[model samples]
Target chain A: MPNSTDTPSNDTPSNDTGSFNPTARSRVKRLHERGKYDEASVFAILDAAFIAHIGYVIDGQPFVTPTAYWRQGQTLYWHGSAASRMLRFQEAGVPACVTVTHLDGLVMARSGFHHSINYRSVMAFGMAKLVADPQEEAAQLDLFVDRLYPGRRATLRPNEPQELKGTTVIAMEIEEASAKTRSGHPKDDEADYALDCWAGVIPIHQVVGRPIADPLLKAGVAFPKGLAGYRDGARFDELLTTNMV
Target chain B: MPNSTDTPSNDTPSNDTGSFNPTARSRVKRLHERGKYDEASVFAILDAAFIAHIGYVIDGQPFVTPTAYWRQGQTLYWHGSAASRMLRFQEAGVPACVTVTHLDGLVMARSGFHHSINYRSVMAFGMAKLVADPQEEAAQLDLFVDRLYPGRRATLRPNEPQELKGTTVIAMEIEEASAKTRSGHPKDDEADYALDCWAGVIPIHQVVGRPIADPLLKAGVAFPKGLAGYRDGARFDELLTTNMV
Candidate 1:
């Protein structure tokens, strides 16, 4: 008999309901078996990543802009100077492709050529729209701050009217999405078992180090207690996502 | 007295002389200050990375393609199956931008808002063209093998006619390029010092583990020396480009 833990869930909600919506998987990858097209899985990957590469067309030329982003439900938001050229995409209703990838570790296979990365990534396709509602935009803006540092939204002065005018919030409702990931150790051939080669994950990690104080900070400002003792290591995204929000 | 090492060369070569051609500082990273653009410095960052996000267009919609790539001189190469949709971009003479970034470490600053990555990235913008010459195509194909594994070009069988026909090789000249880098510890403000926050860099690294043997390999085929003891850490592109052909 197989191990009890190895069985697949028979009654889990299909891709349409619950947290299992895998919408777009075919165009992005050849081996669909390894791709996870579910909405929850896709959102987890996107939220875990701190940076995104947003691609858009400007006057018939293509440009890829790398910036920071945050997600709320099915909507993704990115902020920048209102005068920024990227904001123009939102004004025109142009289709934009936003992508996020987290490189967890490098995978070394028995075959030198099969080396890969242990990563989680999401490619979201959608048409971007400018967030114009004052209350909704303010909530999204606070979410961006909360995403960067948890529980500190009330510590600072609220956004003034001019500050809001100088900032643009562009959002996209994820229409098509796909995620591909590779994890685990090397998959070697049977005959090469006896070969004297070190084979195991070297273990890549992104740890949080001690924080550096800013040069211009006022002398009496104390460090936030929440940021103390942060170490660089892998944490499951589920727990991380909850804590971050 | 100022250090002698900081001075510029007194002599400038004539335009016709080979010496007059200033060393190409990895054309992709021209945005950085000269001191930060050395070949070893730039290559070190490139080798420790994999999977560049490529941006291009189809119709008026922008598309970002994540693909595996290798660099040679001032040119970068990527290929896919002939039938792949990505191949059509090269055939159509459209411009594309490719970016490769190595996330070396995480920046933890006194203020959570200023946190960032210590990264080395190269962005190349140019038109991509497909390789058509049969002999040149064959040479470039061999270059790919030699690139993936240092000593395998002579050992592996040449690409059969069918394989050649099924693959498409596209090369980009890396026209407008820039490499931006942020390294070292966090840059925090002075007032945050007394806050007793620990500020530093969590150095992230990619290391290769032991290789797995292929399951279908013949019982007696020994692992080649070139394939053994390969340390594929975070600096993947740097390793592949510098030592390989």
Candidate 2:
């Protein structure tokens, strides 16, 4: 584990700024006050969900692929088919950017110019390379499953031989990172607050729908307790954070 | 307007494949069957939301920035502060990829190997250029508002003089693009269906919460009908699609 993120802070002034030193790439140039470099702040954004938009370059053309992602300590992990062309290009230790965003609400300012969205986002820059070892790769897969589902891995059938060979896991230790967030009501001009207009937030949320059982499942098979966190109407990110071990 | 996206197709096999020809850069090599090449397929995915992850490279490093986005005919648009570093970097007609994804559901299979998430996503590759013309830039900003909120543009206060110069809008014509989508239940191995496991799809939907009135709003200010589509329980993407012109 990297000492920067893993070590407990002393609550000093330096820790407030964070242990992850901002670089030219990770720095927030516009509205710099919103930038957060603390490990706790960055990890909270990453742990809230398992989806990420990975940015990478093949030749000079950039491609952004949205994929499932998880973080353990300071290392970020994502997997895809071993035969995947994108994975092949990334396994060569490519420089990559992984970004996660959560849309909170829409801020309706009195004027069209002040309209904005409330959100929390993190952008982590790192070098991505393959987890080539079979034993290590298998463990990472288990983490991906158990991380979201808690104890679900123990109840499921084991991976088949072909399944083992077909999956490719990529690991990237975050070298530079930054988190940006905006929340609460719109910050309109002081005078505009008195305008005769409907100005407020229409909050946005990702909620859980009912869990559907497969048609072919055994009649007696109960809904797995491991995934009990997915109950209907629950907040999606909160459930993930609640289940995060 | 480009005939490929605008002209009605005759339901021929080629038209079903899409009017947008797949190139080496935009082709979906893995799961080729899931790849969509036609203009309608690509535009549907793009119009479903106002957010996109833009992939652009600086020097040899890649950066993915999530920003509000809108589509008009063959072109796509997004805006940010004029002083924004990412916007400045992209204003020079830089090669970029704009990706939009909607998480639809979580598919739980009998085995961990078959577990997957259902999603609809589009990747459009193009050269991003600044909308330098003040007249065109102003209209695009209005379109951005009225696009999501319908006629909300007319009810609001006019833009300030500084707001015009403070915002930078970027436009990218869809040069090469592809849409990949997966839906429904888990397609597990046929034999695994007999396993004593609860395998099904837990549907995921982005829903709207209650609209919050600004604390400072006047008592008589009514909720705009243009934004009535944002009522609670409406699916966010569907609402955006409904409001889309």
Candidate 3:
């Protein structure tokens, strides 16, 4: 029997309702077995990552920009300075592909050909539209804060009017998406199994270290409840999923 | 005086001669102060990361695929199955951009507008060419393994002829490249400093955990010396730089 912890929660029906129909553009070509199209798998990978690399084209030239991102349902949002070329181009409803990846481990095998890395990645394709309504933009900004650290919006200073004016938020209603994941131990050649090489996995983890307070922090201010649990050595995935409240 | 460890070794002249002249296509449009054009910065960012998001266009639609990559001087290399769409299009000498990013920390601020992530990223643009020479391709494959684990290629079973034939290696002689880096605490509005919110940085680190040996490993085998320092709690950046023998 497989361990429950080893099985990802992508099969829970509550979060697995809609399936993203992969188009020829969004399909995983190389490894068909690792492809996943379910909403649950896509959402889980998106929610787990705060940064995404967005790819777009301009006059036959392709550019990939790394930026902060947040997801709400099937819609994804990212913001930057109002003058950002990436945001401006994306706001015009251009073809875009946003990808998020998490590195899990290094799979060491007895043979060089079989070495691989365990990772989970999602590629979402959509046309991004500018969020024009001021109220909607403000609400999305709040949600961004809440997504990073839940309840953080209520404690922090609100965005000033000028701040909102200088920022551009673009939303992409995902039209097609797919996720590819690789996990577990290496599969070496049958004959190489008896070789004296050490074969195994070295798990990789993204962890949070001790928080450094700002030099100008108010003397009596205490660490907020939203950040208290984010202690040194805490796992990033655990902090992201468990602190959603 | 600043601590020596805090300064990245980007000023070493032996590796920092040429500057990548920015083409109209590769210029950083916003926040020009963070842009770097020198080879040292670009190579440092590329060497620190094993994975890269490669962007290319097929039929006017852009796609970003994440894959493992290694850098040799000004040339970048990534491999996949012979049938991979990304490698196929890239090998046709189309415009391609390979980007590598390292997320350093989360900047928490008194105002939502100032929240940002400290990161280092490099974007390299070029035309990718297929490595058709079997001997050159095989040598590059060995270099890839040695890049990850120093002296690791000699200890493993060599790549079989069939294995070499099944894989496709793509190389991009970087035409233009630039790096962007942001570090330190958040800079909030002047008046917001008096607010009671906790404002600071929570450093993020990618670390290696305990190694899990293969279930079918021979009983008397010992951990390789190259992997001994990669025990639990080892910092990934330090390991990457220090292990490059």
Candidate 4:
């Protein structure tokens, strides 16, 4: 494991520290100040996001790939094509920046200028290494599957040898990171409140619609209980985490 | 105005490109067979997203801010605090990368290794300039307002002088860009079709829910008729453009 060094003060003072918040590492940014940084605050934002924008450089060319990711302790795991340019360059040890963001709502404040979105985002910088251990890769894969749909790993058949050989998983430990967020109502000046402009948040959320069964789902193999989060009218992320996790 | 350099090619390649797709423009990457670049393809993805990740370097520290954006022709405009560090450093003529992405659905194939999400994303590299002209800035603000709530511009009070002073609108002309997308069912190997694993797309989408009016709205000043799209639960970006433009 690589050690993280905290920059005393840098160009972006917001992210000079490595940790977001310790006490509430999982939900730090979600429930804290927008721009403030602590160990717990940053880690929470990073763990909750389902997808990430992975940035890396190859042949002096930079590429950002959107991929599914899961965080375990301080390390992040992602899998992709064994031959992808992004995977190749990333495994070679070039520094990479991974970002994940969640949009909460649209804040339509009284002043058009003060309008902003309520969001939580995390940015992390580190070098990724290919997951070379067979046992660790299998366990990480289990966690990755459970993150998206809990309890499915034990229900599904085991991976075959050829299947395992074809996939490539990479791991990256968090080196430097920061979490930034904005939430709640519009903070307009008191004087501007009487300007007759609408000022409030247009709450935004992700809700899962009715789930459609597979066209070829085997008869009598009803939808499993753990997969109920995909049903219609479910509140996407919330249902997945609350009911499944 | 920056001059446009047009690249011409004869042999139409179905894939991304083969050294002929305007490689001189630094932002455009030539993935050769692995690339997918088309005008409508890129625009559709860009137009579908309301939030973009703006990445820029200040004093060697990189910062990525999530901001609301509007695209007019080849120009992308976003507004923020005039004194904000993001705006100040962005105006220093540093090269910036803006990325917009929409995750469509989850693709689960026969093999667990092939699981991926169908997504569309675009990344553009350009220099952002402050919208210094009063008339131009006003027009852009109006465009932004119109974007969020179509005819609301005519119904609501106009921007005050102090409000304008507090706001900073930045516009970036597209220099070079690339769009990539993945869609359809999982691409499982022919032999895996008989593996008894579920194989199909779990279609994901962004659907708008009921609109909640501000609690303090004047009794008579109800949601305007021009804002009908906001009620239909259309895709966020489509509703934004139709209502504003």
C-alpha DockQ of every model = 0.23, 0.74, 0.79, 0.21
Ranking by TM-score: 3, 2, 4, 1
- Model 2 docking grade: medium
What lDDT score belongs to each candidate, Candidate 1 first? 0.59, 0.83, 0.83, 0.63
- Model 2: per-residue Cα lDDT over A26-48, one tens digit each: 99877676678888888888988
Model 3 chain B: which ten-residue window has the lowest total lDDT?
A: B1-10
- Cα lDDT tens digits for candidate 1, A1-245: 01011112122224663333444323553444446667766776787676688888776666676767888888788877676667855755778889887665544344333334466667888888899887887788778766755665565545557657767789988877777665655555444345444343444444443344445444656656664433333332332465533
DockQ, candidate no. 3 = 0.79
| Predicted candidate 1 versus true structure: per-residue lDDT over B1-245, tens digit per residue | 01111222222223442211123422322222323333444444445565778888877777777776767766777776676677766755678878676666655555443345566665667787787776776677667655655666566434557657767778886665555566665554445444444444555544443444444444666555665445533344345445533
Best by TM-score: 3
* Candidate 3: segments with Cα more than 4 A from true spot: A1-16, B1-16
Name the top DockQ candidate.
3
Tens digit of per-residue lDDT, candidate 3, span B22-41:
87777776766667788877
What would the TM-score be for candidate 1 when compared with the true structure?
0.72
Q: What's the CA RMSD for each of the models? A: 7.7, 6.5, 4.2, 8.5
Off by over 4 Å in 4: A1-33, A57-63, A155-157, A160-166, A214-221, A243-245, B1-35, B58-62, B216-219, B241-245
Worst 10 residues of 4 chain B by lDDT: B1-10
> What tens-digit string does per-residue lDDT give for candidate 2 at B1-245?
01011212222224544467888898988767677878878887888877899999999999999899999888999998888888899899999999999898887878888788878889999999999999999999999988878888887778877788888999999899998877766767768777888878888888888889887887899888667788888889898888433
DockQ winner between 3 and 4, please give it.
3
